[model samples]
Target chain A: EYPHVLLAHGGGGRLMHQLIDAIASTFASAELARRHDGAALRIGDMRLAFTTDAFVVQPLFFPGGDIGKLAVCGTVNDLAMCGARPLYLSVSFILEEGLSMETLGRVVASMQAAAHEAGVEIVTGDTKVVDRGKGDGIFISTAGIGVIEHDRPIGPEAVRPGDAVLLSGDIGRHGIAIMAVREGLAFETEITSDCAPLAAPVLKLLEAGVAVHCLRDLTRGGLAAALVEIAQTAGLHIQLDEAAIPVRPEVQSACELLGIDPLYVANEGRFVAFVPEAEAERALSILQTEPVSADARVIGHVTADGPAGLVTLRTAIGTTRVLDLLSGEQLPRIC
Target chain B: EYPHVLLAHGGGGRLMHQLIDAIASTFASAELARRHDGAALRIGDMRLAFTTDAFVVQPLFFPGGDIGKLAVCGTVNDLAMCGARPLYLSVSFILEEGLSMETLGRVVASMQAAAHEAGVEIVTGDTKVVDRGKGDGIFISTAGIGVIEHDRPIGPEAVRPGDAVLLSGDIGRHGIAIMAVREGLAFETEITSDCAPLAAPVLKLLEAGVAVHCLRDLTRGGLAAALVEIAQTAGLHIQLDEAAIPVRPEVQSACELLGIDPLYVANEGRFVAFVPEAEAERALSILQTEPVSADARVIGHVTADGPAGLVTLRTAIGTTRVLDLLSGEQLPRIC
Candidate 1:
């Protein structure tokens, strides 16, 4: 109704999807519509995965990581979700005029450490500056390229009715961590962001020949949003067991205090992997062995064909509720 | 001496170079120090070129194109300069809250048109929105990937002592066009920005088997910046013939009025190619045949080795002067 963009348009929820659709309508391509973590293409007999992300998290520095770490890991994980081994990253920074050199150095160091940990090189970058107040302190945008090593196609469209849904680790920590700092909450125990890179675990699945039908990182709109999107894309009902989903005690307590659902909060390092029922156990074991995903658990399964695109959560209290995409911006600039 | 970054840190001048060096020291990849338009890498059996640019051009709607057009073409041309056939681009947008949907739609339309003309696909993208006062109307950052089809390594390092420098077209048009609108200057005819994609002409040169040693697109900081950077990188001296460098009469008049050197003004559609002296005439002919480069001319030639990396201009009146990198910001957010 406003005919202008709102903060919700960047919320990674229903409105963001609609904006993408509107823009994609002007430049329609199947690759763009696939809505995978990245675009997979075959060029000159080589398979490549490409992805881009812009990070504008408020308060620049946070509990576990800063924008620089988020920028590299986000793009690297996107490529890994496509069954690609991230190789190179191109980082571009937009800095406000008066940003401190020391702050910039710290962020750059974080990026270097993240890239090194992910086994990817920061090969090229660009920098642009705007006058103070015209921009936030700094905004980092990264684009990543990786080689597709697995032969099987990976995405939501690959999700079948018989697939199992597995969660890499606990959710809602990242969102709560940011909110706590932004609102100046004093909790007994700090809820640090779980914002480590997920490429290693993802690559292990592909290397071990696990049939990962689809892999999506639980990011801006978190578990509910990711499940709902996959359900819509694959036209299958996603059934989640609320009792089995893992949530750290601090995160749950914070969510309760904040009147927000853990299922709808953003997470940085967590991912939901869809795999054939036959190999879900192997995938779980492999994921659990990874440092960043030690709490991996099977919390859901694809149940039936759903032209209606439904996601239902079976609460621990024996009540069933439908989970939909977050309607509006619950947390702006979370990532 | 300042503890914080100034606008000049992003001006594509000496300060920007120093900032890049400091950032590169953290990451520490030789490719980052090469400072070419893009970084070419070898992964498995495939050769790839990757690059990124953040477009913060003031007045998103310009004389010949908008930020969308620049976003696509700028990244594409960066890859093309590496002798790569540009294949795909990833675009990320940071939109200020309250940006009109109509404006976004127009920008998307321009991006689609430009991508089609350049024979590249916009395969993936990300969008994030910030508060209205915290951001400009819209800022676009694009990362491009292309396949290296040419066997010869192309970059500043490839420039040789006997290589001739060729200008793709007349200089100063793009920069002057922006300045005219920003400063409210009037001319006999409005100077349209020569902000077209340079990939076609560059690809043509590669496909025609031209022995191009190095190629660099003249973007921000213009021809002088490009040449000086190359000279310093290659540790060679470059001599330019002022009379041979093409500049439109109106552009000349505007530069004189503003007391700005045309050599240092930006040009989005122009490039400087270093090629063996024997093929300079052939290269000129091929470049001139392209509509975007019809005014191509042999402007100068590379001279002997020098640790000092000198660039001398032979004036029309037979006077010679050294050209150095612009020490401070002349125009910020030009691209």
Candidate 2:
């Protein structure tokens, strides 16, 4: 259902709501539809978590979702990554002048749909029309606030040397799909962008009481960047098994053809979880059963050895190499 | 002080707390220092107002303020314009790599100073570091949510014929200051950008129970665009005297040299308020007493007879010319 994103999907009214419900809801859950300007939740001892993110993904629409859905999911996931329960969101837009009203309506419908699926509300927003040549078709900035329950405190500081890294599903789908369309690279099989919201899986883990240390969405710079952040934040080293990582054949082929590294690619729907080694299998099984994480796997483990803040990958042939944070934008404006 | 933005300011830790206590609090109230992810105020019936904005001003640091200071004020002003008492703000930053730590600390300090000045707190934030070329230097996005009191909605929907327009202060300082800095036009006298937060003055008038119909921050596109929005929104024509609008001598000379219409210029700290004709004097008197609005004046009046959605300016030549919203940005990255 996704291809060229229409501007209407970014509008704050009814149509945007429909888009989230119909498309993005497939990957999200309830608690996002309240549409409050800020998520009003009760956290013990009066602590709340609020976060904001701006998504200016080029082409607006892609194989799986559009920017409107991505905007909502991005901020919600960011809050979830910080171990916060997702709540309310504020969506703001900068629309290029002359963008079709119908298109704008469609985008807004998608956003509203996404928010409803996530159980959040679009309580307040701002819309400004820019000159046609000044900006891309549209740029959407979403800011969300959530409440972090006192009992569920999780962060990079919670990481331990014996922690196991669990990744939800395949990597590089979002980036490869975007590249396929951008470079006009035809494939024997088409790969869709994995751009779904992931607030529920996190809450499920929190509810499971699985002693999860940290959670982060594997988006821009993909697994490599996400891993680097955890490593640096926790002052630890990580070793990932390349064979255990899931990558669809189409995405792998597309990256190979374009000389793109799959580890550095992007995936909107996937997340990396750092958990105690004892709960690794339980967490993997839980992720596997979820529709969004049918291909979830245990990719790595945090180790006390070697250079701190270094991320290494073990290849299929048993050779290990460093996976570094990308120094430059491999695909500009991809997100 | 001017420098590149940094990661710690968004960390919600000591640096973030310190930032608020610095520049952002220069014009703030005690209630703003709570620094929760979001502010929860008990307004009548629990009504709330939420707003977010991004400041992408060039040079980062300007004559009077930096992007950080501007971000806090622009968003606070938006909440005030909506007739809400601003409470909390979340600052998100897209920082380009290679930004020095020194520059970032300065911006954070300025943000702290400005947030304090505006009567708000930088409660939560997200920071993303892009590759060196992805952004100019650092782009800050601030999202604020406010709680509005009951019986205080001031919108274009409330504007009626015979309503009077009040100019909060001198118009062209912010616009002219930025222009001169951008064009490298030196002046015999230095003109500082009027980049101050204005919630104090607004709350003063609100408490006075003035019959204000609408309010707008004359930022981008200046007085002309703000009036045009009122005219279009209310479907009424507005007439004003050319001599009534205040402009500094340096601003006049800069506008003349650049051939840029001063009307289309941006002002970061000024606002235009539409009030009942009878209460106009009281409003002006209140405005004049505030430091931010020392030159406040009754600039024009709403008209029942004229082209709907049009604004006319009576020039020094004793003739009227229509003022329209300039389609193009008068000054790019002016904030």
Candidate 3:
């Protein structure tokens, strides 16, 4: 009866239910049609893991990925990094009116590809079309659930004072690539965004029986922010040798010229693993053995002292400086 | 060391993990910090129900709610409508470079209040700041994990032909309220958005032994869309007496003036309950007995053959016509 949607649809009224029944049940299975927040899934003896994320990245489409890929990857990896095997994802779209169906199609296709690549399923979704100018072209919210082994316990709190930090490949490449494209910076070599599925590699590591204190994918705020968080959480001071941190020449040059620090730059397709001192070398060996992780190295060590556990970088000249959580945007950095 | 976030933070990268951990560990407990996706919590023997949603509503601040309230309630309702008792929520925020901290504080406070009102706790979160011009003010994403009764099997498929459709109350107030304010439409009586949490009322009906076939919140597309969806999903026809559909007088007038149908308007605080005809009066009584559901009524009945699952509305003239989902945004009609 509505010629235009009244505010009541969002009011959780009869209309909202109808819209959900039509859109969600049309594609989802009878199970999803039950209209529960999550489908009650039974997966072997493994522990069930769940996650959700919202995508509001403007310009929806960037060089390497768009909101679609980010939505899928963000949820899938959230599960995967937590020692879970991703199984399904539920996607919801808030589309502004007048958006081209073609764009939506492409975005959905990209999501499909990301899900397929991660060996997950997009089982349910909702589409809400807003008035033109009422919203941007699109906003996506994705929720993911997975199955994890009960034996695998991964997180920052697991890190001991003597644990060594192992990095998967180089840092700042993804951050710099985005910056280059976003800021229109010139580079001697063109850098590409490092956006990819890490479920496979992470699964491989889990299978190897390596004891990992934590496994976190460094995406935003880079390695520096991650280290600081881990240090503060675990109550241990983290010291990293600047020279030990790996950064590609192109990324480094861009950072130097832009007056941005590579440590705080964002990176996709990379991860940080905190391992015990005794197991650090083995972890590095296992990581470097994989082609996806060619530049793996032990970049820092956790200590028990200094300001109740902070992350600091030791310069080549032997001076130390605090590495703090960035409170602002690292614009001109997302190439 | 994130100098600026690239698309990779949304990627499953080092940046993404740090970004998540930075916020997660900031206020999380030791146990929660260890869980990959906002604490794989164990509360007694109840299996968990997980849900995720992203809020991209235009005008982050609206009549009765803001993006923050919607973010919290959207996920909370998703869990509640599933008949789950919501426990914890995970929040993610994507902020534009220039967004003031004051606005963010207001949003956070609103979310905190909503969470408190729903009796759920905010456990973990993620934050990312995009460059200026690349984003609007702010976008918030929330994911919730709740617990539901093991035997609460609710869904469209559970619906049978002879079921009664019970609406919690009213229609189209939310959409119209947003529209009116956005368009500067003057009215004798100002309409506010109906964005209240429905968990309490739903729990009340369940407690009264309503034995509902399914329960769904009518959002986005309003009553027409919600009913049509239910009809199609349950594979049954629906017949509604237009006069029985309860719309506020002002809302009805507004719909008529705007060439809009209240049935197609969106509602945020209402829901549809498909129950056995025997339980119809009881459900209505139980609903109407509550302060939140005082307007609960039986607007329609599920049928077997005629129209084969189409929704037909009987008008005041004693004639019936099909009701369809609203195609897109009717922006001018919001409150």
lDDT tens digits by residue: candidate 3, B1-335? 54432333322223334444443332233422322112222333445555565565667787788878887887777676666667666666656556665676677778878888888766444444444554556666677776665465666667888898898888888877777767677778888778877778777777766787777777656777667766776778999988887888888888888887777777777788888999999888888877768898998898886778699999989998998654343442221
Most accurate candidate by TM-score: 1
lDDT (tens digit, per residue) of candidate 2 on B62-141: 89888889989988988888778887777666555556645765777788778777767665554444444444566677
Tens-place lDDT digits, model 1, residues B1-335:
66898999988688888888899889888788788999999877778899999999988888898899999899999999989989999999999999999999999999999999999999998999998898999999999999998689899888999899999888999899988888989999889888888887888887888999999999888899999999999989999999999899999999999899999998888999999999988888888788998888888889885334888999999999899889765778888
Please, what is the TM-score per model? Answer: 0.99, 0.70, 0.78
Pairs with steric clashes in candidate 1: none
Report, for every candidate in turn, its global Cα lDDT versus the true structure.
0.91, 0.71, 0.67
Largest DockQ belongs to which candidate?
1
Output the better candidate (2/3) by TM-score: 3
- Comparing 2 and 3 on lDDT, the stronger one: 2
Question: Which candidate leads in lDDT?
Answer: 1
Candidate 3 Cα RMSD (Å):
12.1
**Candidate rank order under TM-score:** 1, 3, 2
Off by over 4 Å in 1: A305-308, B305-308
Which tens-of-lDDT digit does each residue in A1-335 have in candidate 2?
32322233322222334433432222121223321122333322345556677676767888888888888888888777766777667666655545654565567778877877888765555444444444455567788766566565466777899899999988998888888788788888888888887878877787778898888888766888778767876889999999999888888888888898888888888999999999999988877767887777888899998679889999999998997755444665566
